[model samples]
Target: MTVRIVTDSSCDLSADDIERHRITVVPLTIRFGDREFVDGRDLPAERFYEMMANSDRLPSTAAPAPGAFETAFRELAAGGADAIVCVNLSFALSATGESAQAAARSLTGEVDVRVVDSGKVSAGLGLMVKAAATAAEGGHSATEIETQLAELKDRVLIYGVLDTLENLKKGGRIGAAQALLGSALSIKPCLDLTSGTVQEAGKQRTRGKARAWLAKKATEVGELEHLAVAHGAADDIDSFVAGLGDTPARHPTTVTLIGPVVGTHAGPGVIALAMVPAT
Candidate 1:
């Protein structure tokens, strides 16, 4: 059976991976004040960051309508896919997963569409999508892949150091990380997003210290099954990865730019690490 993968723009997977896996990416809407643009389509990351740098208010994101996901599923079914798995951003964070679920319900028996709540965003979500696409390519049944993902989600760990909490504060996504707001001016906030909601991981006086802390945390986790580095237009990404030392993984580590959906909240100069533990 031919299984294809579908995901939203928030996954932050590389273009090559998408093409290689024949994965379909539905886009989310990003609003810069009154002007709205499709994530990654009309509003590329570079352009979004440029506009954000000049704007006084934080941009907002909207989940794609159910029709958008239905269109993607129908197109894939028409292209001869026996089954499709639609992985999406965390259901706890965005309504993207709900939209995909709605679309899947509309398909009924015409085609099989499994909507998975990745419980992650950015490269954390990207890692799961990549694995799903790989499973599809390997001829794994959609049901099997879905079961694998359910187990994989709990093993995924995502941590990041944000340059500022300004975006999180403005976007109202602070969650349990809100306590960091009190000391935002004095320290860089380290966020743990493994739970699909932002929580405080640590605090650092400097960016370098924060990066080191991230690397140390990864080391303490032992060997990794998959590793990915995601950043929001950060220039120090190379150095940040270098500090992580050797990461033993089944696949080569992926370094992806944080797309508009994630970038909207992470803000600029935000760098994060997402990984799965070796089992």
Candidate 2:
């Protein structure tokens, strides 16, 4: 069976990875005050960060409409795909998954469509999409790929060190991390997004210590199947990744700019690590 993979822009998969795997990405929309732009289409990550820094208010994100996913699924079916599996960011965080499911239901008889909520964002979602696409290329059925993602999502871990809690607080995604607000000035807040919720992991006295804690957390996870570092306009990303010091990974480390959708809430100077512990 010829299987195809689809995902939202939040995954942060590189252009090469998307093109190589023939994965379809439906874009979400970002609004800055009165203006709005498509995630990956009109808005580049650099430009988005520039706009965010200049604007007085935080940007907002909107999930794609069901018609968008429907259109993507139809195009893939026309391309002779026997089945299409869409992996999306967590339902708890956004309505993107619901939009995809609505689209899948609309295509009930015309083609086979399945959607998987990654329970992750950014690099964590990216890694899962890459794996699914690779499995599809190797002729795995939609059911098989879905099953693999079920196990993989649990092993996926996402840790972040935010430069500020202002973005999260303003965006109303602070959740349990709100406790850091009073002391937000004295420390760099570490975040845990592994459970699809923004929870407080810990805080460090300085940026260097916060990033070091991230690398240490990865090391403590033991063997890893995949590893990636994502940052939001962070200039020190290279040095941060270098500190990993020959960490073992089944795949080469992926360093990507956090896209506007995630960067909107993560704010600037955010550095995140995503990894999957080997079974």
Candidate 3:
């Protein structure tokens, strides 16, 4: 039986990669005021960023409905697939994982469906999905693929520095007190996902300082495997890559654009580093 792999838009995969690997991507919904758009579908990265700039209202994102996963799973199962592995963003960050699990449960004995909570978002989750797809392409069983993904999941690390605290405040992620303090000091707070939710790792006063701080943290963590540098509209790939320098050679690196779903919350000029421990 052919093994099938699926994931949600939060994975941050490129179109070419998705098609090349035969991976199915389910998109989350992005709502801007009264208008709604599907991540990667109606709302492509470039257009989403442009809309974000024009609107004062902060865009809100929602996990794809259970039916969305159900449709994808059913299609694969109908195509004579034996089993499926649906990977999604961290359950703590979005309901995508839960929705996938619910859909899988509905499928019951007909098909073997496994839902993996990546415990990471954006390219961090993308890296895991890609690895799983690679394993599937190698003719690995769904169970084995899931095991590899589970092992890789814990090893993944995401660290981000936002350009401003305004988006956080707009998203209701930060309180007025913290926002005031962060703004006054020009504090570029470094963040990482711990226990699924974004949390403060540390902070620096400027972009250069923050970049250096992130690199230092990456080195301290050690065993870097897959490295990713994602940015919002602003292009800081050169400096970000230069900051890593020799550290990136310890692992493979992929740079991607931070799409609307993540960008809406992170704000512009957001630079994130996703690292996986080397085996």
Candidate 3 wrongly placed segments (more than 4 Å): 172-185, 248-251
For model 1, residues 1-279, the per-residue Cα lDDT tens digits are 999999999999888888888889999999988999998789889888899999987999999999999999999999999999999989988999999999999999999999999999999999899889889989999999999999999999999999989988888889998789889999999999999999999999998898888888778888888888999999898888787667677768878889889999889999998999999
Residue-level lDDT of model 2, residues 1-279, one tens digit each, is: 999999999998888989998989999999998999999999999999999999998999999999999999999999998999999998888999999999999999999999999999999999999999999989899999999999999999999999998888888889888889999999999999998889999999999999899999889988888899999999899899889988888778889999998999899999999998877
Task: Flag the better candidate by TM-score, 1 or 2.
Answer: 2
Question: Considering only N, C-alpha and C atoms within 3 Å, which residue pairs clash in candidate 2?
Answer: none
Tell me the whole-model lDDT of each prediction, alpha carbons only: 0.91, 0.94, 0.82
CA-only RMSD, every prediction: 1.2, 0.9, 2.4
Q: In model 1, what lDDT does residue 123 have?
A: 95
Give me the overall lDDT of model 3. 0.82
Residue 265 CA displacement from its true place in model 1, Å: 0.7
Native-vs-model 2 lDDT?
0.94
State, as a TM-score between 0 and 1, how close model 3 is to the true structure: 0.92
Candidate 1: Cα lDDT at 135: 92
Candidate 3: worst 10 consecutive residues by lDDT? Answer: 175-184
